[model samples]
Target: MSEENQNQKAMPASLASVAAKHAQKQPGTNPLGTGLEARGVHAWFGTKHVLSDVTLDFAAGTVTALIGPSGCGKSTFIRTLNRMHEFIPTAALAGEVRLDGKDIYAPGTDVTKIRLKIGMVFQKPNPFPSMTIGENVLSGLKLAELKRSNTDDLLESCLVRAGLWNEVKDRLKEQGGSLSGGQQQRLCIARSLAVEPQVLLMDEPCSALDPGSTFRIEETIAELSQTMTIIIVTHNMQQAARVSDYTAFFLSNDGPGLMVETGPTSQIFSAPRDKRTEDYVTGRFG
Candidate 1:
C-alpha cells in the first residue's frame, strides 16, 4: 500500500470515529449542504484579471482546501463562491457557479438567500462586541427572519456543534468579545451554524490562532464536515493535509491565478502530478 494510504489507516481511533459518524450525511434536498461547482470561472477587479478559467467541484459533506502562496487569489476565489466578491464595486466574474446544479448568479437569484445557504467564517475571530454570546448565535437567524419556537435550544445546539458549548454553556449571556480569541472564533462558527448553512466557507480560519486554539478549530472543522460542504483557504499545508479530503493548489506568476492540480488529499500530498504542485508541497518554493 502507498505511504499515504498507510498513514490514513493509522489515524487515531477517535478521529476515525468522528469521520465515520458524520461523513455519510449527504446534502439531500437541502440547498445549504449541496455540492458546489465552478465551471470556467474568471474574476476581475475592473480590468485587472485575478482568477482565470478556474473550474472546480466541491463534493457535498467534504472538506476541500485551497492552498498556495499569498497573492494567488485563493481568498478571492473563495469569496466568489458565495457571491461575496460582488460586494467589491469593481469586481465582476464570468462562468457559472452552481449550487446543487442550479446557477447561483442566474438572473433573479437572491443574493441574501445565497449567503444564507453559504455562510462564511473569516480569518480572524470576529464576534460582535455589543452582543452576548447567546445573542450572537441567534443574530443570523434573526436577520434571516427565521423564527424558531425553541430559540434557547437552537443556541445551545449550535454552540455544541461548534465544540464551544461546554466552555461557554453557563456564560451565554456574556459579551461575545469577552471570550478568548479561540473561543471567539468558535463563537463565530456557532453563529454560522445557527443559520444552518449547507456550505461553510472558511478563509484561513486558524491563521491568527495559537497552536492550541488552532487544534480545537481543526477538530470543529472535521466534525462539521459531516453535515456541510467546507471549502477552506489556508497557507498552512499541514493543516490542509490534516483536515481536507480534497486539495487544490493555486498558483500565480505574472498573470491571473490558475489551479495547478487538485485531487484526493492523500494523492495530492503523496504524489502530486504537476511540477509546480510538487515544488510547493515539498517546500522547494512557495
Candidate 2:
C-alpha cells in the first residue's frame, strides 16, 4: 500500500468543512504568558497515578477541547487546572498550572481567588436546589462575598451570555430546579459567569442533556470564547470540532493518561499528526 493509504489519509470533505469553520479564527492579541499554561503537570490519587507530564497552553479568549475515552484522565486534568483535584483527600499534583505567569499552587497563594478567576462546571447541572432562578445566577457573588452595585444587571448579563435570558427572564422568581436539564446547565454556567472568571473549565457539560440542549450549549460556548478562555473535556469528537479552536487528545496504555497531540481544531481533525489521534477521531478505535 502507498504511504497515504498505509497511514491514515486526509479527512473526508464533510468533517473538513466542519473543522474549517474555525480555520480562519485567529488567536487573541495577548501573549502566551497572559493565558493559562500547564507545564509538566502530573496528577495522582494516593497510590494511583492518573495523569503524566501534560503541558498545554490555552490562549486567552479561545476555547480548547480535551477529547479522549473514559479513564484517560481528561476530567482529572481539567480539575487540576482549577485546584479542584486537591479537594479529593488522596489527590496529589506536581508541576505548574500558571495563570498570567504565576503558578496557581505557589506558596500562600489565594486558592479562593484562583477558583474565582477560573470557574468550573461539573459533568451534571448542579444549581443550588433551594435558590430561585435569579438567586442561583447571583449566588456566586454572595458566596464570594463580593459587592456588586447592580445585581439586577449582572444577573441579566450572565443569563444573556449563557443563552438563557429569554427563556428564564419571565420566571426569575421560580425555583432553579424547575428548569429542564439543559436550561439548568446553562443556569449553572451563568452562576459561574457572575464572578467574571477569566477561564472556564467544563467537564462533560452537555453529556447529560439531549441533542437540542447540546447544540444550545455549543452555541453558548462559541459566544463565551470571545471574552474568556475555556477548556472542555468531551467524549464527543464532533462537539470538539464544533466548539473548540484547539484540541488536545489524551490516551493511556493501562497506565497514566498522557496527552498524545495538540493543535488547531481544524488541523487536529483533518490531519492529525499522531496515528492514535487519527484512529480515535475516525472511529477506528478509542
Candidate 3:
C-alpha cells in the first residue's frame, strides 16, 4: 500500500481506539471549582509540533468547551489529560497537567488510574453492540472490580443520572445496539457515570445525533455538571454558548495548536478579548 493509504487507514483506527477509550470510565474527581489544570504544556509528534505553551483550568461542576477548527490541537490537548496521547509513538510533551493539585503526568502516576477518575465520552455514540443496555451501564463497574450492595439500584441511579433510566428502564436487557442513536449515546453516558467519576470529558458528543437527541444529551450534561465537572470539545459555537460556562478556542498555526482565547462563554461570544476569537466566533474563519 502507498504511504497515503497507510496514513488514511491509521486515522480511522486511531479514531476508533480513541472512541473506545472514551466509552470507558476514568479517574475520580477533583472538588468543584478545581477539577483539572494544565500549565505551560507543550507537545509534539516527532517533528510535527502540537500544543504549544497551552494553559487552562477546568473547573468542577461547570462545562468548559474547547473549540477550534480542524487541525487545531483541541483533541490532542484533552487526550493528554488522561495520557491518551501516549498511544502515539511520535508524541512527546513538556508540561504539567494537574488533577486537583497533583501532577497527573508525574513519575509513577498510574495513567489508567487517572483515567478512571476522568471519564470521557466521544463525538459519536459507540456503545458495545454485544452488550445489553444494563451490561453497557455496568461495563466500567465490572472492569474496575468494585463491589456494590445492589447492582440493580446502582444501575437505576446511574441511568437516571444520565437521563436514561426512565426511557430504557423496562428494557434493561435490550441490546445496546437496539436503541435509537440518541438513547445509545445516553446509554454510553450512563455507562461512563456508573464508575462514579469526578470529571467527564465529552468530545463533540452530539455531532452524530439528531437535534432532539442532542437536546436531551445537552440536558443530561447540564444535570450531570451538578455533580461532575465536564470539559467538552465542539465545533458548534451555538452549542458551546448554550451549554458551557467557559470556552477555550484553539488555533492551528504552521506547527500545531495554540490557545487563541479563553474566558467566560458569554464574554467569549459577546465580547471577546482577542480579535481572532471574535473572528472565529463570528464565523469569520474556521
Candidate 4:
C-alpha cells in the first residue's frame, strides 16, 4: 500500500457517544433561540469607537454572514464573540454576548472555558506544522487530561465531520503542512471540530484559496451547519449570497461601524431594505 494509504488506515475512529449527543440535539433552539447573541454591543479601541450598539443573533445550525467594506469592523466584531479582542490593549467593550443564554463576560465565566465552547478558524489555514494529520485532529483532546484509547476513531470521525476525511484519510501520518492550501484549511476546520465547539467563527476562510478550493470550503461549511452554528465574515459578496442563510451588512460613515441591514440572504441580495446595503451589494458603492 502507498504511504498515504497506510497513514489513513491508522486513523482513529469517531467518538460515537459525543457525535451522537451533538447530533441528537434539535437544530436551532439553544434554549436562547440564538446560539450566539450580541446585544447593545459597543466597542472602542482607546479613544476610537469601533463598534456602536451592534446587535445580532446567530441561530444554531445556520450560517450568518457578516459582509461589509474593508475596515468596517466585521472581523473585529466576530473576534469579540470569542473574546479575542481582549488581547488588544486598546480594546474595550460594553455589551452582552451570550452563548446559550449565558452571559460570556460575566464575572464568574471563565474565558478559557467559554472559548472551548466557541471555536474560531482564521482567514488563513494555520495547521501546526509539527503535528501529523492525526495529531492535528487530536490536539484538542491532548490537553483535556482524559483517558484516550480510541485515538484512531476520533481522528477519523472529526476529519469526516469536517468533510476532509476522504481527501486526507490516506496521509494521517504526513505533516499537516504537506497538504494543499484548501486541504490545509479543511484540516484546520477539522482541528476546530475535534474540540467539539458549539459555535464556529470563520474569518474569510476561503479568501486565500482558488475557486476550486473555495468551493470545497463552502461545501464543508454547508455540511458543518448540520451540527454547528457558523458565523462567517467574508468580503466576497457572492460567497455570502451563495452560502449564507442570513446576511448582516456593516458600514461605517463618520461614526463607528454598525449594522445597516440584516435579513434572509435572498432579500439582502435581491431587495435590501437599506440603500447602503443595496449599494454595497450591487457594486454601486463601497
Best-matching candidate per lDDT: 2
What lDDT score belongs to each candidate, Candidate 1 first? 0.87, 0.91, 0.82, 0.81
Q: Could you arrange the candidates by TM-score from highest to lowest?
A: 2, 1, 3, 4
Candidate 3 per-residue lDDT, tens place, 33-141, comes to: 4678999988889987888999998877777889999889999988887788888999999899998899999999877788889998987899999899999999987
- Please give the range of 10 consecutive residues that has the lowest summed lDDT in model 4: 12-21
lDDT of 1: 0.87
- Tens-digit per-residue lDDT, 44-138, candidate 4: 99999998988998888788889999888899899999899888998999999999888899998778878778999999999999899889888
Candidate 1 residue spans exceeding 4 A from truth = 1-34
Residues 1-286, model 2: lDDT tens digits: 4764444355655555687776434676643337799999999999999999999998888899999988998999999999999999999999999999899999999899999999999889999999999999999998999999999999999999999999999999999999999999999999999999999999999999999999999999989887889999998888888888899999988999999999999888877889898888888887
Between prediction 1 and prediction 4, the one with superior lDDT is: 1
Candidate 2 vs candidate 3, TM-score winner? 2
- Candidate 4 RMSD to the real structure: 12.7
In the order shown, the candidates' Cα RMSDs to the true structure are: 4.5, 2.2, 11.5, 12.7
Top TM-score prediction, candidate number = 2
Among residues 3 or more apart in sequence or in different chains, the pairs in candidate 4 whose N, CA or C atoms overlap within 3 Å are: 4-170, 8-169, 11-152, 12-152, 12-153, 13-152, 13-153, 13-154, 14-153
Model 4, 51: alpha-carbon shift in Å? 0.8
TM accuracy, model 2? 0.95
Model 1, residue 233: what's the lDDT? 98
